[model samples]
Target: MKRVVFAVPGSLDTPTGGYAYDRRIMAELRQLGWDVECLDIGDGFPLPDEATRSAARSLLLEVPDGLPIVVDGLALGVLPDVAAEVASRHPLLGLVHHPLALEWGLSAERTDALHRSEQAALALVREVVVTSPTTAKLVASDYGVSADHITVARPGSDPAPRSRGSRSEVPHLLSVGTVVPRKGFDVLVAALATLAALPWQLTIAGDLTRDPNEAAKLDASISQHKLAGRVATPGAVSSERLAVLYDSADLFVLASRYEGYGMAYAEALSHGLPVIGTTAGAIPDTVPQEAGLLVAPGDVAELAEALRRVIADAELRRRLSEGALASARTLPTWQQSGAIFAAALEKLA
Candidate 1:
């Protein structure tokens, strides 16, 4: 049997797109007849203490020599020394969602450190797997990885029924993502505050616990704008509930600062919902011009203007909805993603 170790940080059940991609791809690889063993390297990764670092090193050392092992970028990016030590003994494949240096809210020094570390770690890997072409290009250009050594296996979206839309007198906007600075819920709230005169309601569904300070700031902003009655934050939700939200939402919005792959945007398209997002990262690639409007990240005025146009013009919304459905049809399925991912791994074997 073709066996490999998939090293990931923390639990596989985390409610995040990256984790979801890892879990789904691992399962699919197993179905393809590869013996994929998962190795959880604990939490506080990319900023691990000495003890955590030692543990990760020990775990990697335990793997049999010459076996291929896939390491999640979140953990591997910060462990250049450990990765360097392991590279000679095993075939290391890096599965990077995005570079850790690109994460939002980092000090200049920290960003530089992560960038250097990630570049060093990636240099030692035999090949790198990215979720989007944007990231593949990034790894080649910024991290010094050769283009030929990179593989892009985009995330897959499930087929969903088109949204019936909200019956409320006002339009219902839905945003899904963990409440982190990167997700830019703060920017979304600031934009929505400007559109208070319009008849629209918003519900943000995400894990508030992921970043409590950011969540608290959002709550304060909602209250300060006197939009307490117009917005809802339901925290983390189940897959079934998220599907229901998509079905009922008039529009799907997320003003994320960056995205390695905008899974939520694709999910919105699957439900035939118009998107209101930024032109950050891979968003423009995922959301077509006809399907929605994209403004520069952190541009509150532009976001508000886009929101106003969509709120007042039902015809424009209809056109975008049709466009969304068209775009969704072009998205790759999970099964297809698995095949691509399997092919990438098989090459190493």
Candidate 2:
């Protein structure tokens, strides 16, 4: 039987896209008849303390030799010593949601530190799994990993009912992601504040606990713009609740400075909702121009213009929604994504 140990940091059921990808991939592997064991190595990853790092290393070392081990980049990038020590014993693979260093809003020194650490760890892995083509190219060029050594197993979208849209007089906007600087919820708020005269309501649904500072900043921005009534910032939501939010929304928006794959954007498209997002990172790759309006990342003016154009024009929204449905038909299914991941693991043995 095919067997492997999947090491991940934090809760397996975390609502973030990275965790969602891991959870789905693990499930898919089981469906494919692989003996998959999940190894939770603890959290505070990508910036874990020394104690957490040591504990993670010991947990990774516990995996039996010759059983392939796939470590999520969140933990692996910070555990260089663990990678080097176990590379020869267990066939090691890395699942990178995105390069850690490229995360927006990091100081130069922090970015440099993360880059060195991830580069060192990636060098020892047998193979790498990236979520998007843009990330694959960046990983190869920046981390010195060969293109042939990487697999791009994009997050799959389950077929969803086309959104019936808001029943309200005002257009409903939905944005989903953890409240963090990289997500640019602050930028979205800034853009929306300018268009308070427009008839629209926005709900920013994501984990507010992940980055308390950013969450606080977003709150301040909403108040500063005096848009407390038109905007909602509910924390992490249940699957059923998010589905309802998707069903009731007319437009989906996020001003993320960067995305490894933009799983939320894909989810929006799967729901047949028109998109308004930035062209940064893998967004353009995920959000086709025909289905959405793209703007420069962090540019408040451009984002505002895009938001105004989409919210104000019913014809544009309908056209983009149609395009979004067409694009949804082309995204891979979870079963297919799992097969690609399984094939990559099969190659290890």
Candidate 3:
């Protein structure tokens, strides 16, 4: 049987979109009879301390030399030395959801370090797989990795029921992602604050535990805007609960500063909800113009304007909803993406 080791940082069961992609892709590989070893290399990735790095290095070293190893970019980017050592014996591959250096709120030094290490790691890998086309371009150009070395396997979107919407005159706005600075939750909340005169209830649902200070600041912003009643931060929700949120919501919004491939936006499109997001990274690629309105990242005023128009105009919402469904139909299934991912690995052997 074909064999490979898939090393991911943290719990494979994490609720974030990146983890979800990892989970589905692995399942697809297994179904194809690949001997997939999903290894948890521990946490604090991309910025792991010495102890964490040592533990991760030891675990990776234990993998058989003949089997290919696909390391998630989260930890791999920062572990260039370990990757080089491992690549000397194994056919090493890198799965880059997005370049780690592109993440927001990093110090200049940290960004530079990540860039250097990732460049070094990518150079050693047999192949690099990215989650989005935009990422493919960036990695190739900025990181000096060849386009031929990179494969773009976009995230799959499952079929979802069209959003019935909040029957109430007041619209329900939904934004989902881990509450981190990179997500631009602060920008989203600021935009909503400006639209307080409008009748809207917002639910920013996703894991808040990744960055407690960011979550607390988000809470503080809601309170300062006198929007505690209208806005709900229910943290991470189960799949069932997120589905319900998508179904019952009138609109979806997330002013992310950057996305390797905005899976949340793709999920919103699949749900047939109008989107309000920034034109950052691969967001414009994920949420097409007909399906959503895009604003510049971190521009609260622009996002607020987009929000004001979509929430107030039902006809616009209907048009966008139709577009979202149209866009959703074109999205690949998990099985298809998985096949592509599996095929890439099959060729690696």
Candidate 4:
């Protein structure tokens, strides 16, 4: 049997898009007869302390030589020295969801350090696998990885039943993502506040623990705009509850500052929900204009205007819904994504 080790920083069951992609692809790979072992390297990655670094070093030392090992970018990008040491002994494959340097709210020095470290670490890997073509380009241009050595295995969306939409007089807007600066929940809240005159309710479902301060800021913004009754944040919901939210929502929206692939946008499309998102990162590539409206990141006026148009015009919503359903049909399945990911690793082996 072909055996490989998948190293990650935290629990495999984290509710974020990257973790979800990793779990789904790994499970699918196992079904395809590959012996995949998951190794948790502990949390606080990409900014790991000495103890965490030592733990990672020890864990890697125990892996058998010449094994094909795939490391998540979160841990791999920060461990250039470790990657260099292991390159000669193992076929190291770097799985990059996005560059760590692209993360928001970082100091210039920190960003430069991360960029340099990731560039050095990625150079030692046998190959780099990214989740989107946008990310592939970023790796090639910013990280200096050769185009020929990189592969794109985009996230796959599950087939979903068409949303029934809100049966109420007021439309329902759903946004799914962690309440972080990168996810731009603050921008979404600000834009929604401008549309208070319109008849709509907003629900943001995501992990509040990822950034407690940001969550608090979002709550303050909602209250500042006098939207306490109209806006509800139930924190992160289970898959079953998220499915219900998608099925009953009138539209899906997220003003993320950036995204590697924007899996939630794809998920919205799968449910035939019209999208309103920013043109940052891979969002424009993932959410086509026909199925959604795109605004510049942090452009509150444009976002509010787009939301108003979709909410007031029933015909527009219907047309966009059709477009979403059509677009969702073109997305790859998890099985296909797994096969592509498997092929990339196999090439290195």
Candidate 5:
């Protein structure tokens, strides 16, 4: 039996796309009869430090030499010591949701630093697994990594839309993600402003990361737009509440300037909710022509128009909802993801 270790930034308690990916992958691999282990390198934001690097190295040393190890690109990018240690022994595999350097909003200094760090980390990895082709291309063009070395293995969703709710009377608009600038909540707000005459309510759900400044900005935006009654930002909801939100919502909007792979989009579609997203990053892969609407990034007018179309036309919403749900049911599970991953690992073995 082969032993596989997945290195991540933190525990499953604090959810992030990278964390979800690792958790699902480990679960699926375990089901497949591989001896699976997850090594949490510590959490918070930014990146790991020297002590975390030491912890990763300690974990690496514990794994037998030549073992297949998958490193979370989130924490690994910033840890050159960890990269150096992994390079000396195991065949390193990188699972990058998206490169930190390519995140939508970052200062020039931080972007450059992340770029340097990611380049160093990529140098040690034998294979790079990303959630989308956009990231695969970014890794090749920005980091000079070979495209052939990178594989795109996207995430799948299991949606549960509510059947009892009256969709016509209460048009629900849902947006999910950590309240961050890159996710484009500001753009969503701007779009909502355009639809002020409409009776629809918008719900924003996700952990508001402990950054007070960003939180203040989001609060101020909601106030400035005077969206108090119509907009809801219930920070950090449970999975059950999220499913309820998806079930009740008429449409899901992701105004992100960029995404590695829009898992929420898939989740919304799975719940039979039509999606509205920008034509940026991997979102195009999930939002089929019949399932959702795509607008140019930051185009509030376009989003508002799309919102109006979906809200006013019952037939259009019903058609797209059916299409989206069908698409979701057809999506691969994490077990399937593991099987494909195992095939990739076989070549290296």
Candidate 6:
């Protein structure tokens, strides 16, 4: 069995989307009888200091020479020097969900730092595996990584858990993602304000980070729109609870301005729920045309119309729900992700 080192800067215990992706990938790889070692490089935030860089180097100390390493772009992109050193010694492949420079809400200084880090990280890696073609293009164009060196591997969703007996009163409109500016929650709130008469409840499930001002803005928007009764912002829901949310919801709306990959959109589709999202980033790739409606980013009127349409037309909902579920079956499983990852490793190893 080949041994592969998977490095990232987040705890496996956290409920983050990147961590979730790593966990799934690790499990699938292990099941295939590959030896996988996980390394936490610490959170790649506010730029890593000297201590963090030392810690990263230390974490790599035990990794076997010539073994293939799968490095998270988010983590490695912040520590370009460390990445370069590690890849020089071992066969390193980058697993980029998206580039940090393209992330929303980043300041010019941080973006510059991220771009520099990313350029360095890509320099050290033999190849990169991105979650979507959109990201692959960015890697090639932005980082100057050759197209042949990048692979696009999308994710699949868990099986829909047993339905928590359907609710009859209100149609559930669910949005699952971190509550940040990138998610376009403000736009969603504005759109919801236009549809006060609809008997639908919008549930926003995500972790609220350290940004108090952003949180305050979201809170104020909810209150101002008088959507306090209609919209519920439950911070950091458990996966089991999230599964329940998916099962219970009548529709899923992801008004994200951009995404590396819309994993929640796949989850919603797997649950046989129709999705409504903007044509941003990998959303258009993840959400099948038959499963939902796609609109321009920040288009409140279009979003409102889509929401209204989903809520009022039962037949349309049923058709979309069925189509989404059917379309989801065609998505690649985690095991496939593992196989693809292993294949990438094979090229360098």
Q: State every prediction's TM-score relative to the real structure.
A: 0.98, 0.99, 0.99, 0.98, 0.92, 0.94
The digit string of per-residue lDDT tens for model 3 on 13-124 reads 9888889999999998899888899989998887799999999989999998778999999998999999988888888889999899999999999899889999998999
**What's the lDDT of the predicted structure labeled candidate 6?**
0.83
Off-target runs (Cα >4 Å) in candidate 2 are none
Deviation in angstroms for 343 in model 1?
1.4
Candidate 2 residue-wise lDDT, 1-349, digit = tens:
7898999998998889999999999999999999999999988988898888888888888788889999999999988888999897999999999999988889999999999999999999989999999999999999999999899999999999999999777999999999999999989999999899999999999999988988999999999999999999889999999999999999999999999999999999999999999998899888898899999999999999999999999999999999999999989999999999998898777
Query: For each candidate, what is the lDDT?
Result: 0.92, 0.93, 0.91, 0.92, 0.78, 0.83
Q: List the residue pairs that clash in candidate 2.
A: none
Q: Give each model's clash number.
A: 0, 0, 0, 0, 1, 0
On a 0 to 100 scale, what is the lDDT of residue 92 in model 4?
93
Relative to the true structure, candidate 3 reaches a TM of 0.99
In candidate 1, position 73 carries an lDDT of: 98
lDDT of 5 by residue, 202-290 (tens): 89997786455766788888899899888888988988887787767777888988888988888787777777888988888778878
Better model by TM-score: candidate 5 vs candidate 6? 6
- Could you tell me the TM-score of candidate 4? 0.98
RMSD of each: 1.0, 0.7, 0.8, 0.9, 2.1, 1.9
Candidate 1 vs. true structure, TM-score? 0.98
User: Quick one: best lDDT, which candidate?
Assistant: 2
Model 6: residues with Cα > 4 Å off, grouped in runs: 44-46, 161-166, 210-212
TM-score, candidate 5, is: 0.92
Which pairs clash in model 3? none
lDDT by residue (258-340, candidate 4, tens digit) is: 99999999999999999999999999888898999999998899989999999999889999999999999999999999999
